[model samples]
Target: MGVDNYKLAMWTFLGSECFFFGSLIGTYMSYRGKSLTGPYPLDVFDPAVTSISTFDLLASSLFMVLAVHYAKAGEINKMLGWVAATMVGGLIFLGFQYYEFSHFVHEGLTLKSNLFGATFYVLTGFHGTHVAVGVLLLGSLAWSAKRGHLANIGETTEVIGLYWHFVDVVWIVIFTLVYLLEYT
Candidate 1:
């Protein structure tokens, strides 16, 4: 009765997400280094800048954890504050991604350019979409919190936190396999 069904549903959704992202990652790996053109991985990937974005996302995860913690403690204002912070972090991450994508397109790496371009865009683009959706969800949660309409703050925060963490984790894997591995 106490969010047991909600928790189960979230877990089921996350289980499917695992497969969804797994296939994308797998496709990216398979197509890595197959792009027979310029603006390739080395020519485009700026790890230093991307590292900053990655750190921001990781920090957002921390904020989400704190938000859930405060929600569980019934501290509505603090939870909302942390949720706002998390949304800002997500926006920053998306900004970085947008800049990167624009730069890539400017540098002549379109989705149809080659295998690398297609796979890279498809994979990271999907991830970016997920982040955008998370931002919207968090924004909605914030609005609900402000309106005093959220009945189960803890459960709500926990469910959204689960999704936020999944997005972060997927980026970690993508950063490692798609970017770091390229350098090595």
Candidate 2:
């Protein structure tokens, strides 16, 4: 058969997401050093913590790959296990983000604090929202699989895997530019 409609739609959606995140990253970069206040990126950012969170997100991509592989092989149990693992990884990353945001606020970095605060929170918060959405999608997939409602597990899992990998790639860019580049 030709390309699936759902997969095509997902690719289109991801293309738009790329532009969306590009604009966000551009805005953040434009205002990177223009903050006229305390708690700048260097002052509040802890690379160590963010590094661990990045690792978690990256690991989730591997889980997503395994999930797709198992789904395609008609191994429902293994696919479900990998899906759950991916969701856990996403959740753990979110937990890290929550803690990091809390620490930033406690350190006086609010959205209204300065240019750095506004751009930083907006970009990273949107990313966290995307991660949460991915987790929910995986969760629904798991529920459907468990209930024997997902008829096309391989195709569905592959589509979701594409989204997950896109999310992970975006994080790599963010981690490099927003986090790692600060020190260089």
Candidate 3:
């Protein structure tokens, strides 16, 4: 059988996303430690709080897996439940990010404050935008499943799953490079 168009499209999109994120990360790495100001990464980063957000994002991947499994099994209600759970996880992670950004601003970090602020916000902000989009997609899937409008639930869920997993993996890299590695 030929590869499904949707699956192929999603893979192509993700390939482009890899390059997009790679450039952001590369820029961040090149600018690391060049900030000659207050609220540098070491002065403002709180890895412990970010760790919770990371865990929430990782847990959403589990929910995505369950969503796909139930969709394949033709269990609409279970699929909806899992999809909603995943969306909730994404929302919670975004909340944590919002709080962190607010705290940083209060601590004197802004996009114009220093190179660290600019690159850090740009990288993580874009990642957060991706997560928000994923949440919206999952929300739409849940709504469609509820209305019995999903024609190919299994294939659709799997496509969404690929995107969700990609976001999670990107966060793992970001968390390691931006948060964890700052200490070392």
Task: Find the candidate with the highest lDDT and give its number.
Answer: 2
The true-versus-predicted C-alpha distance at residue 2 of model 3, in Å, is: 1.3
lDDT of 2 at 49: 90
How many clashes in candidate 2?
Answer: 0
- Candidate 3 runs further than 4 Å off: none
| CA-lDDT, candidates in order | 0.93, 0.94, 0.93
For residues 1-184, could you state the per-residue lDDT of candidate 1 as single tens digits? 4646777798899999999999999999988888788678888888877999999999999999999999999999999999999999999999999999999899999999989999999999999999999999999999998898989989988999999999999999998998888877
lDDT of 3 by residue, 1-184 (tens): 5998999999999999999999999999999989888688988888778989999999999999999999999988898889999999999999999999999999999999999999999999999999999999998878888888989999999999999999999999999999889777
- Return the lDDT, model 2, position 108: 97
State the lDDT of candidate 2 residue by residue for 32-58, as single tens digits. 899888788899999889989999999
Residue pairs whose backbone atoms clash in candidate 3: none
Q: Per the 3 Å backbone cut-off, how many clashing residue pairs does candidate 1 have?
A: 0
User: lDDT (0-100) at residue 179 of candidate 3?
Assistant: 89
- The parts of candidate 1 lying over 4 Å away from their true place are 1-3
Better model by lDDT: candidate 1 vs candidate 3: 3
What lDDT score is found at residue 173 in candidate 2? 94
Give the per-residue Cα lDDT of candidate 1 at 164.
96
